[model samples]
Target: MSTRNSLRSAFLQLKRRSSTNTGGVWSDFSKRPTTLKINNAPIRQTLFSEGNSEEGPASLTNGDERLAYHSPIAIDETFQMAYRILEKEANSKYQIVDRLEKSLKNAASQEETIEIKDRIDKNLIEAEIENPEVLYNAEFADSKLLDKSQPVYRHLLKEKWENYDLLVTMQRLEQLHVIPDTLPTLVPKADVKVKFTHNTEDQFSKWVTPGSLLPAFAVSEPPTVYIQEFDRVEGSNNLYTVLLVNPDTPDLATNSFTTTLHYGLKNVMLNNVDNSIDVSKLLKVGPRITFKEYTPLTPEKNAPAQRACLWVFRQSKEIGDISEASENFDIREFAATHGLTPIGAHIWRQKFDRSVPGVRQMYGLGEGRVYEKVRSMDPLNL
Candidate 1:
């Protein structure tokens, strides 16, 4: 197979696995190659691309819609509750209505979108006889995860679960009880040389603090990451795992978060500090690979700032035979269960607020594109 074809096939395999395990969002993702030329060099595009006409309001079509249909059933139940609450509050109902309309218009299929619109419109026109809480009881009758008292849970519904990826990450962290008070520092100050070289600038900051958003253009492609542990003992076989995740996939329908495991590497032998690990090259190795490759960063407009996180873990020998953990690999669970502790980490924020000329070339989005800013949850919220 051609190189491009081979890569696409690999992604197809992952897409099937993701759909089967994680609600099947990837199964419906577009197969077209979305490419862009930056400084006369081409870069890969985001995983999902909703093929909406370029002339229409960008708000109507951005990010993934499959997440809406195949999301956890609880999300749909929550949306129903939000709909009922916003219905009673006449003062702030229009804003919610407009958002809902946009989502309905952008549904994955015409039939599905129409069905949703009809059901919700019917509810809106009917008399407010039933309490929204009553619907919650009926819909989530068997669910223990729902808690009305916790605004955070309610907030997830309000935001349409856009922070789904981050929330899941936080859930794992909370389970392990890591980072008791403050968010852990993303990148530790070490002798490592890390830089994301762009034509406009090069990012070599000593550290990136949590809760800050970096422009998507600044991180269009994977950065050059190198680590050197001078304190390593002689004749030691030290294997490390590097993980990159985006927990802020803006679901256009519900405006909630869904996560994408952008990149992950396991059993990478870090023999010496002088040698560096090139992430892009490592992706070429196959079969055992968890995710396909380092997908370029393109945070959708009108979505929350994406938390682009990188975590490093030192593998322990006692935690043997981790080859079985592939589909929907949960980093938090893997770390806790396998006794792997994160040694170094870093985070970059990306939002689709500004026009990235580079990305425009890839998606065929013309100039003067403006992405409405939306409120995203803090990573430390968990």
Candidate 2:
């Protein structure tokens, strides 16, 4: 279909169900709607003040009669602001405890029940935020294409659900028209394009070509490889393995692969020497891969090292987001090599939620609660 018509149809289809102000079609595709089952969030009232708006209408015969009676306890302003930030990202446990403690007063009166309740609520929000349903995973959402109840499919109807970074299920389905029993393109080629970028100052590209599978086989994700071909010995095929990780940022799921890694495979070299290996038939790319994930405090284990693992992709493109990389993106070929089976929206929905890594090192018990609280209170701020 023509880009304009497909976009128009997507928008019209979405417009039929949702009301949006701008960028309506994209919103409908990527939105994640939170289920509102529990509805009691305490909004602490500030201490009484002169000309307080809490006093209600000016025409009231009595001041107390105009407003509902509030308790005599003074609400902690700093603690309350701290609570606001805490609840915002309740899903992030690591940050939650820190945010909550920031609001705690060194001393408080014993009679303050509300203040105590606030602390308890911190625990409650943490539990709710930990659920995988609160997060949107690409794999899970994709498996649920047929299930109309899923949000990624249903979100295509919401007016405010505009920012979808991943490709739509329908577009992926249409991609099947071109290939058989193969990995479907996750996005339209015209949308995202990837490319190679050189450090202007260095002249040498930072992209790594792998030396051997020993580095890639080290873990499930790719590692860094730091061998350049131009300055290598003769009879060496210049290639390297590239890897990437999720980065563990809230609401961000990242996937990456390398350009090529068949380095020095053309002829057997009895000895290693220092010379430029020409890369005449291979494509070189700079890629970031996730290696070992470490504990938040201890960076030794999983902190990825640059120039680490190098793996091959079905096809290589320059560095960029979806729009720039989509042109050379080869999701179909990558899936076949990576052991990813073709799944529908219904299946992917559950998978996406299940694999969300609810309590990763970056977001632990305390940080999770703060994330949820902050998100619940001010989603736009995220």
Please tell me which predicted candidate would have the highest lDDT against the true structure: 1
Kindly list the per-residue Cα lDDT of model 1 for residues 194-304, writing each as its tens digit.
346543553433233333456656556566666544333223337666777665555444545555666666766654422356555455543343333555557555544
Query: Which TM-score value belongs to model 2?
Result: 0.17
For residues 34-101, write the lDDT of model 2, one tens digit per residue.
33121111111111111233454333557577675432322223433443454345435424544555
Error of 2 at 208 (Å): 21
Model 1 poorest 10 in a row by lDDT: 35-44
Output the lDDT of residue 204, model 2: 24
